[model samples]
Target: MEYKHVVNRIMLMIALFISIFLNLQAQSISDSSTILIQRNLRYADAPLEIGQDTSSDRLLDLYLPHTKPMQSLPILVFIHGGGFSGGDKGAKGNVALCKEIAAKGYAVVSINYYLYLKQNKIQGASAGANMKDGLPKDGKFHTGLETAVKMASADTELALQWIKNHAENYALDTNRLAISGGSAGAMTALYTTYRSKQKILPIRCVVNFWGGLASTDDIRASAPPLLTFHGEQDDLINVAYAYALHKKMKELNIQQSEIHILKNMGHAIYNYITKNEINTIDKFLTSNMPAYE
Candidate 1:
């Protein structure tokens, strides 16, 4: 009887210890993860707009935590989706996403890059066609929509460069950077991270939302970890690309990737980042990233 009593007492102590440890961890996360926004920080001068340098279209909103932890925060550079011709860093949905991610102890930069406007606009009819069939030109002549995408990717690269240059100002860890976007923004993210003609930054991860690749051949063993969210019924970008991405990663022995296909969903899942997905992203960024760039 005395032995059983001692055993029960030991079990209770272990349970208590675990509870205390978990509570401390929760407290730590809650304490250090409030958001602080530095709005409309111009990452670049507008080279395309008439008013150019004064235009807000070239700006970025930096979302970060109130408390800078011992280690610097990893950055997530977001591009908004408007078929490369529209979308803003301060859009309602974009703002919500930036804040939600910033609250997750990350530094999020939502950038407003150059867009295809006026005579440069690629009509909607061919836009979808160009998305799947118009990339990896590898020096082939670019179509209107393709050129628009290229310009957007270049702007995204500039944003990343800007973040790297201003890393110290925001306590950011450029070595652990990730790029993310929805629709057209997702395409820019993929291209900027993978198919850029010049050497882009060594991206640690990619968050693809209903995005496709010009060619899966661009992805190789050295590609960064990718987390894709796709809608099964998405007509704009289709869900097949997500499946193909998963298959290619498997073939390359790249284990740090995932594809989440939402049922009965469509292209504009801009507001789809939920608690579960956020947890997955947090784990992917922390667990999948290697020590080096």
Candidate 2:
């Protein structure tokens, strides 16, 4: 009887040890899976030049994923809004957005373009007031604005070309590129991708946040797909621009284009980007430019 009792106790100990070992193994696997799913992203602030100009306006900031995937990653080139006379690549708002995009597996680059009003000063009145006055008698006013837009577009195009040339060094997928910006920056992006004569990598799509073109007449069947977000109550650039562009795209049978007119929203769409909007943008990008793998 004593021998039998001792044998039973030993069997119980063995079972307990096995159970503990299996539980520990399961926990280890769970921890590792969590770690694999969660990754850290990295960033590089401005002073990174993308053009021949050494001025701050020609600089850019970059955001990269933590882990380098086997395949090159798609990139999002962001332009900042300052009415084509201001704004920076390191602007608080732009940096935040770039980080968010990088976390989602995209390499993001925010660039600075020469401001139209910076070099050409309209004596006395501020840029805002001058813009409101419309075509000043001195003629510098209208010319400045036009030159600003043209320079901005040229700088953006040069930046795109630079990215393409250095894509391999940065682990970027040059073929799967997207351009985005807010307000004035959006205008620059639109013009650079659609109107610039200098050929570069084909833009897969565009994200226009309250951005408009001087004329949609230049839009062609070959224009890239577009996703526009505009507030119905936008006071700066009329909501008509969004509607007009949407109409043109439809007329041209551009099937992948979409415009989301947020009710009661204004020019500050960037401040109001919700999870639903992010998800929608993600879906659009994914559908248009799938991951390399």
lDDT of 1 by residue, 12-75 (tens): 9999999999999999886555777888887777675545422226788898888766688888
Instruction: Pick out the ten consecutive residues of candidate 1 with the lowest summed lDDT.
Output: 133-142
**After aligning candidate 2 to the native by TM-score, how far in Å is the CA of 29 from where it should be?**
20
> What TM-score does candidate 1 reach?
0.79
lDDT for each candidate structure: 0.76, 0.73
- Cα misplacement distance, residue 115 of candidate 1 (Å): 0.8
For candidate 2, the per-residue lDDT at 185 reads 82
- Pairs that collide in candidate 2 are none
lDDT of residue 229 for candidate 2: 95
TM-score, each model?
A: 0.79, 0.74
List clashing residue pairs in candidate 1: none
Which residue segments of model 1 deviate by more than 4 Å? Answer: 1-33, 50-56, 117-119, 124-126, 129-142, 197-200, 290-293
Tens-place lDDT digits, model 2, residues 136-181 = 3443434555566677888787778778777888888988899999
